[model samples]
Target chain A: MRTTPAKCSKPNFKIHHRPIISAAIAKEQQIVGENEIQKSGFNFKKYMTEKANSVNKALDEAISIRDPPTIHEAMRYSLLAGGKRVRPILCIAACELVGGNESIAMPAACAVEMIHTMSLIHDDLPCMDNDDFRRGKPTNHKVYGEDVAVLAGDSLLAFAFEYISGFTVGTSPARVLAAIGELAKSIGTEGLVAGQVVDMVSTGVKDIGLDRLEFIHIHKTAALLEASVVLGAILGGGNETQVEKLRKFARCIGLLFQVVDDILDVTKSSEELGKTAGKDLAVDKMTYPKLLGLEKSRQFAEELLAEAKQQLEEFQSLMAVAPLVALAEYIAHRQN
Target chain B: MRTTPAKCSKPNFKIHHRPIISAAIAKEQQIVGENEIQKSGFNFKKYMTEKANSVNKALDEAISIRDPPTIHEAMRYSLLAGGKRVRPILCIAACELVGGNESIAMPAACAVEMIHTMSLIHDDLPCMDNDDFRRGKPTNHKVYGEDVAVLAGDSLLAFAFEYISGFTVGTSPARVLAAIGELAKSIGTEGLVAGQVVDMVSTGVKDIGLDRLEFIHIHKTAALLEASVVLGAILGGGNETQVEKLRKFARCIGLLFQVVDDILDVTKSSEELGKTAGKDLAVDKMTYPKLLGLEKSRQFAEELLAEAKQQLEEFQSLMAVAPLVALAEYIAHRQN
Candidate 1:
């Protein structure tokens, strides 16, 4: 309710918070603009700060005391070692936009972070990416060794569910279960594993097509992102219809974000990226930059961003969705 | 109902069902005892056989896809490659005994199998137990190679939740969520990882003490077994009181099972174990039989079995629980 309404139709404003009558939804044709409220994206920096602190607390509480402190320590070290809290912030922002309280989606936010952290841990393992640096520090397996890293990732992944379903909470059990289900699918074989397999197999192959590229991003990066936003909506009290629209919006953004990331890999520097740069090419891995070419990739991202913004036209205001739109834009241009 | 009046009171027969339990739990428990009135042990073999097929079916259905067949194949191979199916069978049987449908508990059953498979797969990795055989077949890493084996374990772990939350209908979402919570804790740093860590570090440390010995098995073996029975009660309509009692029962059985298993490992040949025997000795790992010596380990298992059976006194009928009671006896005596 504290959100601004100045952007209702301002020329300078790229987004508005009110629902648009100009839409492609077949189901919403009749009642398109009636009783529709606009939603703007929330503050990325502020949202990240608040949610990061909360998620850090939950993660800390979740990882403390594993008898032998090695895995717990490694997990905490990787988790707390700072990176932009983009995924959790998106979850919280999406939750807030739909009129639901942030508390309902907090577990989900923490869970997503845990998933991300776990993936990072495994990616850094010697047998995998073998990266020595993460978040500008030595990677988990680099510091803790392969066994500890594997266990750390395993612990984090499991604890993600614990943080949601096991935590004493305000959310309905059904919602929690649904969130868990969505997360499991997204992070599991059909999503993350399939994507990883494709990525792994793509190495040493000369020509990677758009289909395989889409498959990789959809599973590897976008699936969890889509889950985060949709979960936010579910926790935020959105009906099924609203949730579906937001899911589409998030899907576009997630893909766009990754495409931008891939593009940045070709264009950015390690100092600007905060992590190693151009590793994709180093490993001969296929990326959006490789598949679409830089200019075409940028165009593709813009199209996705436009589609994402259009999806938000269903809402009444730009306040709840502005950050998301901005985030997509930022992603499109991010050096990292 | 087919179970008749027993000749006398069998202490373990308190939960006994006539040829299994009353009307309600049969569909859920899957395997029924010979008769309701009979007084006897809670044997798990029948329960294991009955539920194993269905669980494998559910697992197969859960992994459907055009791509990622390699991951699925490895996961399925490890999942169905035999083993007693003890933990999953316990989950289903517990659910049935509580008067819940097996279909409702099927997800939990499959989840346990997934967790168990993950443990086996990881344990078989070169850095871990390094075995080429599990339950009489080539271990996952042996057949699939270490990289696929690792991903396959991860895939199975993720798919467990997907299979459950995606497939089962009519069950309370809260229960499914709660089951996930239980599993995460048991499998995370607090239970399985913690146990494995201690197990890993304790290797070649021949000067291990009793307290350390308890710690290892408590986590490695008991945590999952405790999770198994607890999940059963959750899905089977068990009240908190019943769940708590069953957890205690499971804890005891878990330790006892390990003791017996360690004993059998020393006693049985490679042909009997379907893997190399004397593995603990070979790896110089700490085990119950290693620390306590054979006779003491046997005595300990028997004591634990008796204690486990004693915890079942509260169940309404002995016949319904015969399979479980018999399982306690069999745990101590089984050769493989």
Candidate 2:
């Protein structure tokens, strides 16, 4: 069996709560498929490091410092700053799982990273989240000034499409167009932007329940993550069934990532995390930990992870699915 | 002979003004080539109205209000707001000149307009130009708060590529890919974004010369216009020679648009012009009228128009090229 709930759950847990993805958890976790896969000895840390390094190299080559240095500097600053490279890695791994190699996925991998970086930069603006730091450095607006930050964000967004459309080699134009459509849908009003506006609107309003919270997280965080995986699969020539399965897998892990983030907010100190901790509690924002008790939240995370892993079991080659299984576990277990 | 040095040329009109496109202008203005073409009597005003109406209809159908209300509302507000529809018209006209129809160019036409609208929204932001009104009403940020306005602009930008890549039908994938590349390049650091940064940087600097002014205009204004025309040519199956000639023609007219804009700055009042007139001079910003002086700027405008029309002389079908010639004259003559 898994570890006892007592040892895993936070001591400060409160029981008065709403059901957070409990239905999804019940539906998705019937089979503990990934437990066996995990025991088969996959070194997730090693896989992540190797993939992250390659993605970094590709991203560096994708964008170089050019004329009008400030915007480029701002772009490179946020882009190169250390993140886990999770989305690009997910993209690459998904591509590989569908019988494509790393080279076929690199342009799209870099493009997703660029889109994520620009979103972060824009989200941190003074008029937006007003955050002064991101990824352990001053935010784009802080370092480059708001004007350049805005332009840099806009430039990065535009260039992501340009890079994907112009730079992708060894792929059919049909697949490329499909990938572009997916990327565009992820960021538009019905996707990332839609989530952002509602999240902003939800602030300071009473009765922001678990459903509302999930809507925001799914749109703001999960949408792009879904796009990342789905685009990779498409670029790799995954068939309809394969693409749909991976999309479901991506959505679960995407939500799992946010639930874990909310849990960490209450459990980790700012010094340990490197960014402001307990920001959710301070703002009284709606988070999983706020809606459900910390214990239930952790349990919810596990259920989602299990569900995510179950989707991967459909792929016949267990070894090919190892990296993705490892990724879900990483999201479930990361400290910051 | 053209107007003499006294009545038209600004006293400050440096006779040695780099002979800007004089050879091309001389070659192009040969009446021996198209003087009879001028007598062919194309009705530009009627052509513009009909084409603009169709393009506006396509653009309307291109984006619609959906799920989350506010962001969609903001997007629709700016996109559907009536402008001159110049870029879309240019795209369609270029396609027609190269022997293609409106249907083949509509997606790209709408895409270019989307890009232009997004740029205008961002440029009007408090962080950017801080303008309070645009397209005859309160700007986007004024209508839907700044946060939503920024997102709206971003959504529009992303959706432009999506609309082109996804909705475009009856076009070859190679042409689609080429169009995407050209559109992306027109908006990135080397294109529209570059122009914006330089224009921002040049605000208060001393001795802003004509070269710097041209650099700003070429990137800011001309790049997208060139993209608009060239993408149309590519989509219409224009040969390399046709594409390159149209590109040059577009570049001339694009600069002509800005030159006329600067002249209007000095000549029109804020009431007469929808936007703030004389704002450029008020800011002590660099402008064509300021450097070339009003009379000489007009002469430059005329030369550029001649140079643009000359490029179309190679088309060999005068009636087919009439709309473009009429567009050049329109840019030179538009009041607002």
Candidate 3:
């Protein structure tokens, strides 16, 4: 018999992520016709560490190879840090999910990460967030100083597109072009910039309401998240139906991710959080938990999960689908 | 007729941009061919207004239409200001030159301009050049504040690729991808970032030689200039030889343009130069005139022009090549 909704759902349950695959992975192949509903969920922590190390190596090599060490070094400083490689990993995972290969996704994945890295570098700049720390270490600006940090971010953003453009990804030009377009939209004025603009302006304002908050989080964080999954699906050569479903799942997960981040800002210990805890509270920044009480915020997160799962309902018991499904749930439930 | 290094080539009688195409609106065939070249010269003053207006208009509309206005507005401020659309204009001209087409070149052109615009916006920030004025007006950060300026620059950079990726250019995906890669590499850490780093590090240093000055100018200004022309050629379907030759010409002219700027800093009136004059000197920034005597710098500029024209010699009589032929000379000889 199916477990009760109460039994299946946990508002505060913590998992060591030891089980490896979500429970839905078992049912995937039998239920879904061809989808890999039991795919391994990306280990965000592990993936980040691995990718960060690779990036560091790449940064070091890049520095030695380039004429001007300082500029490349600055770019490398941020690119190598141990931030979540969620964006690039999504690109790879999605490409595989759609039955596409990994080679094509590699460049796109790198590009997305570069763009993401650039954003973080700039965001932590003195004139913006004035952040002294990120990923439990000194921020890019803090380590490299302001000028190099600024230039590094710019370089990374530029390199992102360049990397993707050079990749031997798809056999079709249309698909490649589409991928570039997807990336551009994800990082450009419509996505990151718009979100950043509002966030910067809205700082210290306590009453920013849910709609505005949604707008900020959606563009700032969710756009790239959606793009990441969509890129994966597109890379996988999935049809429009699958793409649509994945996009919706990604969207739900993106929102869930942000809400959880907000909740963690208040609930997580400083050590667990990596960076400063309660910094949001100290700054008076508007956040989900701030506007909606902790329990209600948790409820909103649960709602997002339900919506996300519904998007994948058509795929049923496919093991490949499990990764995304697990990821969405994890976004809501993870402590940090 | 063969005006070689023979008889003091085109002496103080250097050509001026006399747009020979009185029939820009004539038959499509005429407008499509060598005739278009007549209208394609570096009319920095004229192109600046139109290109600046259309691009800024699109930028303004894009930002103003966002859900929250502040962020977009901040981005819009610096972008809308008038500056020589040298890089973008070159892209279009090069595209038109090779393919007799502008359609495929427009997106690349726009992307190049967007990237260039972003650089300027950030260059004006407190952490970088910290200039109060740009193109005779308040720098982006000065007018919009540092935070907004940073976001605006970031927004534009991301949007640059998006514009190219989403274009209806009907060019080969390979060429488009290649151009994007070039753009990314040129602007990213390997090129621009490296240049900016050196520029910042060398500030207040006395008696930096010509080599260091060349390093800064090449990466800071010439990399993108070279990319602009190369991107145009690649997208416009020029043969490899043509593409390479144009890159050489662009590099020469790019450096010459900066050399002229440095000279202007020493010589031109503030009103004539538009922006604050002699700022480079104030910061002990190295410039051509500082390393090489003024007369020697002027001679060097002239010599660079000769080299640039020589690179274009293969296409000299093509008539379509005349604009660039004249344009390179203008870079060295311009009053401001």
Candidate 4:
């Protein structure tokens, strides 16, 4: 089997191409070494590029301009707007990790991204965050009138579920239903909406603490991320245990992604990311950097990365988890 | 069985309690003439009250205030705000017409109502129609602020599919998935969103003819009502042909409901319906009364009612269709 020892911090650690141990054996071993077999050969940049391309193509084809050219145009404009497609890629990777193929998970991958895009569009509305720009361009409401933008957001969201349930093929009905349920729960009041509401109400409140901040992030960011991963695994025909493991791993990565984002906001200038830097601080929005100092926030990100990586330990093959591991590292180290 | 021949316009029409013909024979006969035996024993008022009460109970239990109580409170407040519960009743009635009990269709019934309520909440936003009141109470955005109102609408829409897929019992997975797809499609861009966008863009524009007006109403109102009835029939195990026929019936009734609503807007005083009367005329919004004369609008409603009733002629038992027939008449004759 091909092995890449150089990817690991310790010379003794090896990246094995073949299954190293059964999950039960791995549990017994309690695989504890941080320097063990990191499998950096996953080539995350290439994987993400490929996955993003597929998701983008699928999303582009998903919506068409029907009647009332205005709303459809608005929906496609925001939905097809460029973003990293992180949630979808994570979903596809999770599905593959659980012995499922991309065809079975692609519809759901598109769904998560659609939901994410709609949330961003609505969040940037004048009555909401009131941000004029998103992804270095004018927000949806800025391009379309507020009325059309609102309807566009609603349309995208409704289409997400429709595409998933109606367009998915070669999958068991049970799995598809399960995935739909998971996707819905992630966005409703107890999840993304809850986080958004709390964030909106907590703005400029001095008494906000670590717990409240965590609550916001878990709902706003992690809930959807976890749903994406869990849905991929479920639709991929993963057993309950496998789905749960991926959920935990995704939760860690979700929180890690946000922490690193907060860190980057303080560390990078506005020109670097094409977005306003230190805006959270300017608005007195409760963030990891605000609740914990920058140093502690960085430490928290590292801890989350470690926890995310640890969840992958039970996988039969490092190769199977290579993409997920690389994704965690990418979140930890992304420059933008 | 109790029969009320007096309700029929023709004395020759008789209300039959038993199945008079086999489905095959009924299809072959292509029964015509309005003076045929019609089931007049159905008490629409009592049936609607019972179904509405049950649906209200189900919807009340469907959503709960969890964390971030503000959004949940807003969602429930708007959702539980009393309307006639038309969508849910249609769903239940269609299911019964297909020989399925209310238990088989209640989840989908609740889901359609949730979707309807969400649409109303979003439509009343300051950016949309900007209506201050709905169902005789302050609008969601008016009470909760626009930010929370948007989130509340989103939460309800998402929770709708989640509740149907997760909480549904004693139904096949295929039917449940199919119903979810139908519900999503009805509310998406080609459906409710399409209607809303057209209405918003065409506002204050003169020369909107009957075709354009029908286009708006077909999408804005008929789509959800059609979905409600079709989904209920599907969940109740209606064959494809049966479901399709019911879909046609629903389409007619849906259009009829709108035309009557337009007629009432012109004829009723504001005090009668507790809503603004002649508001459509005030805004120059195209309506049945505006395009066609009021007399023609009333005649159009009657034609639609006849078409809707004609679709039910193939049913083996008049008892199965009595409520639906009554609903059509109610739509045609309702003062408000």
**Candidate achieving the largest lDDT:** 2
lDDT tens string, model 4, A1-336? 131101111223221232223334433543433234343355667888999999999998888776678888998898888889989988988999989878888999999998998899999899988988777888999999898888988998999999999988877998899999999999998678888999998999995866677678878988899899998899887898788878888887887778888889989988787777888889889777777788767766766676667677778777777777777778888998
Model 2 interface CAPRI class: medium
Residue lDDT tens for model 1, B142-188: 88777678778777777777776776665677777777788888988
> Over 4 Å off in model 4, which ranges?
A1-40, B1-40
True contacts kept of 4: 0.90
Which stretches of candidate 3 lie above 4 Å from their native place? A1-65, A168-171, B1-65
Error of 2 at B26 (Å): 3.5
- The DockQ assigned to candidate 4 is 0.73
After superposition, the stretches of candidate 2 with alpha carbons farther than 4 Å from their true spots are A1-35, A38-41, B1-18, B23-38
Q: In candidate 4, residue A97 scores what lDDT? A: 91
* Real A-B contacts recovered, model 2: 0.77
Supply every candidate's count of residue pairs whose N, Cα or C atoms clash at under 3 angstroms.
60, 0, 23, 0
Number of backbone clashes in candidate 4: 0
In model 2, what lDDT does residue A15 have? 17
On TM-score, the leading prediction is 2
The root-mean-square deviation over C-alpha atoms between each candidate and the true structure, in angstroms, is 9.4, 6.1, 8.8, 9.1
Provide i-RMS per model in Å: 1.3, 0.9, 1.4, 0.6
lDDT of 1 by residue, A1-336 (tens): 212111112233222342322323423432221123222324555755776787677667766754587777888898888776678767877887788766777778888888888888876766666789988898987788777788888878888888878763666777777777888888877677777777777787877666566668878888888888887888777888788878887777777778888888788889887789999899898887776678767666665665666667777655665655556555556666
How would the docking of model 4 be graded?
medium
